[model samples]
Target: MRRSPWSTLVVLAIAQFMVVLDVTIVNVALPRMQTDLGFAPDDLQWVISAYTLIFGGFLLLGGRSADLVGRRRIFVAGLVVFALSSLAAGVATSPLELILFRGVQGLGGAMLSASALTLLMVTFEHGRRRTIALGVWGGLAGLGGTMGAIVGGVLVDNLSWRWVFLVNVPIGIVVIAATFFIIRESRAIISGRRTFDVAGAVLSTTGLLAIMLGVIRAEPLGWGSIEVIGLLAGGVLLLAAFVLVESRSAAPLIPLRLFRTRSLSLSVVALGLNSAGFLAMFFLTAIFLQQVRGLSAFDTGLAFLPMGIAAIVGAVVASRFVTMFGTRAVQVVAAVISVIGLLLLSTADASSPYASSLLPGLILFGLGITAMGVPAQVAAQSKVRTDDAGAASGVLNAGYQVGGALGLAVITTLATAHITDAMTGGTAPLAAAVGGFQFGLLIAAIFAAVNIVIALLSPSVTVDSATATEAAELEPVAI
Candidate 1:
């Protein structure tokens, strides 16, 4: 007998959680890792950048691979690579080794994340079941990022910073083993010659790499720097070439026609903007709590617990509401809530108390962001063809990563300038920093507000006849 679809979802969710958690888990442990590995201050950023660059860069390729190759095969392969890299990263004696291992870990993450989503999409039939599954997937993914701070802080405080990386070993092993017993292999059925879009993959991967690299370095090197400008410009040109090639190729990595699907296209844009605002809030708040309020990493993590709870509630609520009302309505209402949350957060200062000032905003922001995310994700997958599911999911995921990088880069730059102005105006250093963060929070609020328009533009209906057709095309194959 086959395993339950819910059982497969559990396995995939666990793996996806592990991958997304790594995106921010290292934030609290960076100092410890730097000191232990003898990292220069300037070079310390590489530990984060390397992973982001590689993971975001290769996501498109990884997702498409899931379609061409077997999804289960790619998923298992990703787990092994990720687990081994995590082990090596934890044991590294030098900064270079750690960074190298982290980059490799990112490659594994790209594969694992993309295939996991494909498996979920193909496993669940369209309608309420798929919506619920997507909600669970989206919620866990969002929570993973928030929980990273808590998990990292606990590990670094109780054990060593190495535990942050090493913790994945057992989890990965269990997930990999469970996959063999529970999940069946599945691949898209191609009618013509099974040719991979080699040219499209290369162009898109390298182009995205260049873009991520440019964005990551912009804060340090300045956007106007020759290196940053060259990388960004080159990435744009390469992506343009990739688009051109895709239009001509018989078997494109990403079908240009997918963009014509209004629901899918709009949902992707909405998700990207959702990530931009949502992630920037987390980044800014972490710094605000640690630097301005002088909270220890552990304490800062504890303070975020309420927000995590709120997010869980929001996720559940969004899933139900979308079924009752539709994605467009839920998204708009949820985003409005997020805008309010961020605006409330912007009023906080160094002297603001957690209970009175920070807690309320955190609760609202978490709820709104997660609620907003679920619908956006559901809408994106709602109209996708089964054969195109992997590619569409890849673009959706890539949009989230790239949008986040852009948000952080832009918000950080703006905050820095604000702080500089405040310091120059004779504000004390601590006060200036607070003011800058407050301003940054305001900008994040703006980003959240933009999602309202995207939500409005999204397809009005959630379930369509096309969804049933898509579901008909998917079937599970036992190995």
Candidate 2:
């Protein structure tokens, strides 16, 4: 059966949006969930961290599985798991149950998200069609975080915190039903080789999970505490071992050779840095609007609508710009724009007005992030072999999640320290909080500045019309 490209894109985009939305949707509902479930102050962090740890840890494995098993099959399976787990989360009567269900949701998200990108890459030709498809993909990706807050607020305020998880049930079911009709199954060709590298998967997944856990715990545990140090050290050592295992494996989970492509390597680095700043902005901004400005959840979500709209517009513009110029040039320009936005945000204080002080910076930040993200995604996937498409997508996403986790931890620590110092100096509580947020914004600007340097130093690669056409025609090869 033939499928319309537009239909396929719509279905996949919905799935991707749901997965990404879950990341931030819970933030607005956290207080309610804690109160309802009787969660401890420290344990509440687990609601977010649990999902992140599993999602980041298993992304590579999930991507590789999509290549080895089948893209469409894995995607459907992921949706089922996601929907079921979401249902469980909604009905959870205890904190442990909610956390457990969230972890399962993350596992499903990893599988669905990795497969969705690989499927998109294969479904559309790599020319103007693919570029446009990725533009929509990038735009939705940017909007999901912002929209999560919006949608979450509405659901929590009007209904209950449970609605945040319950909402995914209907969306997941629709995507799953659509998948059977609109998506085609594709997998890497395997000869007599082993289907997967078990050792590599275990080592890599455990290593990444440890690293994420360590970072998430660092703020609460004290960065220099023995537990944090031990976790970080163990994670690094395991990752080193995973490198050794992959270097020699006949069927490695993530091909080490992929990094040899300069565009792929640099794009991954840039994506990580950009995500670090992007997510930190979302986190701190939400806190500032609510805690400092005294906005209701509904109002805070409304405040972000302009930024979400701007991100979609920026994504469209980025696609056209990438088509006209090149990924390297567009990325550099985008990073510079993001730095300017972050600096503008650093000027915010307790008395700053939303329209005058916040809106302008939010617009620039939204535009710059989507612009940077679209090109980076396109560049990362440009040079990969068809058989390794899933792996490439997974690695890129893993970088984003890992970078976000680390960035949030580091920036939060800096903000907390600044707030304590300011309070000690006799600053009022509200003033101290605003000052800390401003400090975090400054550090976030530094992260974006690093992205600019990376963009400048990265090798230039252009996807012209002719080259894109050639890439579109390339077929999968049997291993």
Query: TM-scores of all models?
Result: 0.83, 0.85
Give a tens-digit lDDT track for model 2, residues 69-114.
Answer: 9989999988999999999999999999999999899889888987
Counted clashes in each candidate structure? 0, 0
Per-candidate RMSD vs. true structure? 5.0, 4.8
| Alpha carbon deviation, residue 75, candidate 2 (Å) | 1.9
- Count residue pairs with overlapping backbones in model 1: 0
Rate residue 42 of model 2 by lDDT.
43
Q: Note the Cα lDDT for every prediction shown.
A: 0.77, 0.78
Which residue pairs overlap in candidate 1's backbone? none
Which digits, one per residue and each the tens of the lDDT, describe model 1 over residues 284-349? 676677777877777777887887788767766776777678878988998999899899889988
Deviation (Å) of 324 in candidate 1: 4.2
